[model samples]
Target chain A: MSTETKQKKMITDVFVEGARKGWNLGVNNIIPNVLMAFVIIHVLNITGLLALLGKLFAPIMAVFGLPGEAATVLMGSWLSMGGGVGVAVSLFNEGLLNGTHLAILAPAIYLMGSQIQYAGRLLGTADVNSRHYGILFAISILNALIAMLIMRIFV
Target chain B: MQEERKVGLVSYLALIFAIIFFSGLFAKAAGWLGVFDFTVLNGSFGKILGEGGKAFEFRGSGGSGAKDGFLFALTLVPTVMFALGVVNVVEYLGALEAARQLLTPLLRPILGIPGSAGLALIAALQSTDAGAGMTKLLYENGEIDDNERSVFAAFQFSAGGTITNFFSSGAALFTLANADGSLAVTTPMLIPLAVMFIMKVFGANVMRFYLKATSKR
Candidate 1:
């Protein structure tokens, strides 16, 4: 075959191979987390645990320049960023978050959202060892704190 | 001894050239070069970066109605799964080893991680979960030391899977829809992203060097 035919064949082959591998990955590794996160976030929201936690952490959140109610967003974020952002929207609707507040919260939320659950689930699954989970978890919170401080000072 | 030296020098040079070449190819494949700006697949299939431009509305049904996290979950779970799946394919195929090599220049000098750590970091940039998974894979394989693992996790956590955000709720960060139907994307909206990146890198290195110092002691 000509070089051109060989190149075309190679491209198609790569695409097909990539799609199959990705499919397998999705099925085996990531989909479980998707379901797990969804359920946890849903249960927390339904159980009203998030709201209570929000109230509990209200003062600390104020230090972050966030309203006490914003704690739920933080709690949800511990489960996943999606959960955090999801909570954020509800907070915005309730008027607890304006543009400035949202902007400030966005950075830190983006940074450390999904900390605890991610560490518990993926770190072990990835086989990074169980001992470091606590440390990684602490770093996630620390990172969020730093990002929030940056936003409070700058944006 | 003389012949071994000749082979080592040639192999090192060849690896350098291969890294440069493959890195370029990876960037293009990932659409970082803006070649995918106008490209559209099917509607509902999602647009490339510059395509839709600014249609991000954060008011998912999670806020608008039911006041539950369900709607957001629908969006979030699928996206996480998909990003992981795609990256996994490449990783499973062992393409990440090459991407890992290519990204070594960026991660090593800054994060003090070995070249192989690039595989996980790159995955993390796209999906924090996958990045975590990759890092775990390294540890399980005995590819990284305890200190290296700690520092690397610090980096991943702080940076927090950047491109994952870009593809998910982060797309909204780039631009927000307004009451008047016009899109608003300002520099301030993006400040957090840049700050987060810098802070993560700083955090990782601080951990890395500190650990290195203490380990030496």
Candidate 2:
């Protein structure tokens, strides 16, 4: 029955189905993750912890032409890409990061994004050897770092 | 469980349309042509008067906490819906099958994996779990070996769910605008996308090299 209906489905129906998925993802995933990120940024800002982080990572982040506070965005992204975008936006609103910073950090976020979750979902499900996990993590971080370098040249 | 299907010209057209739709190349083109662009079509919300008679979107300015986040998240919903809708149409038109056909022959040179992994590779771009599940099946069925699985896993692990996730959440960054309403992130949308893809392959090769070196030792 499902296969028969699928064969009869129109392009518009397909679009609607996908849109429904997007809606669910928005309500369930994006909204919650982004809200948490915004609240976290708010907390970090009020506590001056964001400033301290900026100052602390300023030197390292300087290599990527980002402020130290931008480190928080990467950290957030490592947890979840949506959360990373949320943090990036929150900082952008506060004027800590400009458009150029966003461009530089964009690819880097996803390049190394969501590894903690993927470790379980990707590695665990695929049954790759546990011994290879460390190298896999290292390569991803390396990919992200190199991506930033390349992005810096362009934007 | 995908049945082998003939890749048609329509599939290639869909693939091309998908690329152009998201590329931003037609974003500022004159008149009707602008419809091809994602950003132009996604459009913007109307401005409403805020405190002191200043104009702002519904989200307002200088917002913080859950309230602000909620409003911000609200603005993102339409974009997500629209992007995914287009993705669905393109996919239904068989763009992914076209991609698999093109990608199959290059898998060995690019990732040191057999052409058989091509379907899983394309699936990985859309959904991490689906890709991982398929990859496991491929390995268990003896289509790919231990080393190849590790390298492919490296590709999937980093930037998992590349296409769907990027177009959805990553679209948020592309939608960002300056106070003057100019698009932020001046680098074209395709640039970051291409960069991430290149880096994914690079990461896979790094795993390939690590495997080769370790095996000899």
Candidate 3:
């Protein structure tokens, strides 16, 4: 076989293998969870559950310059990013949020969303103490706080 | 006789984190998702949301409302699943390892970590758990040092799963824009990401400084 033929074969094989694996993982792992989040969030919004929660968080949320209802999305984010997005979509549909609102909330949610299950375990594997886990958590929030400020002044 | 192991500070904090995480789910049960009522409103609150004879109703027909929003988010399902599928393929093909060198120009000068940490960063852009798992594996294999591990972990926690967040949720900006003629999604997201990246680099360095000061190793 010619060298050109061998190179072509290798490239084709890798992409084919990679694509097959990617499809399987996405279908199995991502689809069901995303679907569940969408349904649950729709139910929550339709039932006015999120609005009720937004009221309770109104004061604290106000401090961040977001609508009271934004607390719902922020809280959802702490659980999972999917939950956050679901709530945000529902809120946007309800006309409760704007682009600026989502802009601020997006970075904040991204910063702190996965602290519970992922960071502690990751740090633990590196022999990082739990105290530092909390510190990093605080830092993530701090980053969000700063992000919010940037959004206000520049974005 | 059974030996006793005392509950430590870490466990206590972990419990707190768990409480906050789960509580976020039922924020509505606590009446937190909506300030007054997420349901149909009355009077002025209703006036603001309803606006122009358009009521905020679930499955509300027409007028760039809730039903459309739900469907718009649904549109993302295909984009997200396909993007992640590509991510899976890239990772499967060992693209991360190959791309490690390529990312060095940004990683080393900007983030202050070795170029190899790029693999963990790439793994993290899809899933936080996967990123952490890869970092743990790398640490276990002695591929990175103690300080480097801390730096990587800090970066992982901040902007972790960023691309996934952007495609799936950050695009909420797009829907919000299309609905109300507001902000664009991509550019705004890129700035936040840049900010987050700088913050992560700052965090990594801080941890590095702390480790050096404490001399724990």
Q: Per-prediction fnat values? A: 0.28, 0.83, 0.28
Using DockQ, rank the candidates from best to worst. Answer: 2, 1, 3
Evaluate residue A6 in candidate 1 and report its C-alpha lDDT on the 0 to 100 scale: 32
Best by TM-score: 2
List model 1 lDDT by residue over B1-217, tens digit each: 0010112343344444333322222322453543322111100223233334644334332243333333333433333333333333333333534544556888768877777676577678767677877787677788887777888877876546675453345433323323333332233433665677777887777676666776687
Relative to the real complex, the DockQ score for model 3 comes to 0.17
lDDT of 1 by residue, A1-155 (tens): 33344335443455455445444544443344334544554565578865676688888988878887676666667676755665665555444565556666776676677766666555655655466566666676777787777787764
lDDT of 3 by residue, A14-128 (tens): 5455445444533553344345545665676678886787788888777767788887776677776656766675666566776667766767777767567565556665575
Clashing pairs in 2: none
Tens digit per residue, CA lDDT, model 3, B171-205: 33443334333333323335565666667677666
Q: At residue A51, what lDDT does model 2 achieve? A: 97
Calculate DockQ per candidate and list them. 0.24, 0.81, 0.17
Q: By the DockQ metric, which is better: model 2 or model 3?
A: 2
What lDDT does candidate 2 reach at residue A26?
Answer: 92
True contacts kept of 1: 0.28
In model 2 chain A, where is the ten-residue run with the lowest total lDDT? A1-10
* Backbone clashes in model 2: 0
- Weakest 10 consecutive residues of candidate 1 chain A by summed lDDT: A29-38
